[model samples]
Target: MSTGKVVLGTVAGLAVGGILGILFAPEKGSVTRQQILDKGNDYADDLKSKYNGIAETLKEKFQAVKNDAENIAQSGKAKFDEVKNEINRPAANY
Candidate 1:
């Protein structure tokens, strides 16, 4: 149902269909085997590239969230410290 799933299904279907077509075509056994091997390698490389891209995007998103959390924590701590200091001050200092 998701876009990623649809795309993956479509790609898988296309690869399977292409390999089947090549298998059924009239050709020398060696040639047919070579073609299948070439196609498989190409598909593997493409999948690896896509995986790396997705991994990089996830890493960037994770880093951004981590930075935001750190900033929020620092801000909260600074406010707490300021309040504590104020509370401990002498009434004459107010």
Candidate 2:
């Protein structure tokens, strides 16, 4: 979530920065508009790539945590069964 927010903020910053920079440039109106459009598209692509990478990383981490929890639960269940069997064993006759 935080990574998504950061990417959003970055794209916003780039857009604002590009607009401001283009506004001050000496180019004609049509050329400036085109430049801004191109820049916006580039920034959009960058944001998409970054967000996808973050999503992949998060998925991997989540899977790892889930696997760890399952292993711990299995170990605990095995230990309980061993203790239970030991307690239920019959006593030897005299």
Top lDDT prediction, candidate number? 1
Best TM-score goes to which candidate?
1
All candidates' TM-scores? 0.89, 0.79
Q: Please give, for residues 26-79, the per-residue lDDT of candidate 1 as tens digits.
A: 999999999999998988898899889989999999999999999999999999
User: Counting only residues 3 or more apart in sequence or on different chains, how many pairs clash (N, Cα, C under 3 Å) in candidate 1?
Assistant: 0
CA lDDT scores, all candidates in order: 0.91, 0.87
Ten-residue stretch with the least lDDT total in model 1: 85-94
Candidate 2, poorest ten consecutive residues by summed lDDT: 85-94
- Clash pairs of candidate 1? none
**Deviation of model 1 at 83, angstroms:** 1.1
Model 1: CA > 4 A from native:
91-94
Q: Residue 76, candidate 2: how far off, in angstroms? A: 0.9
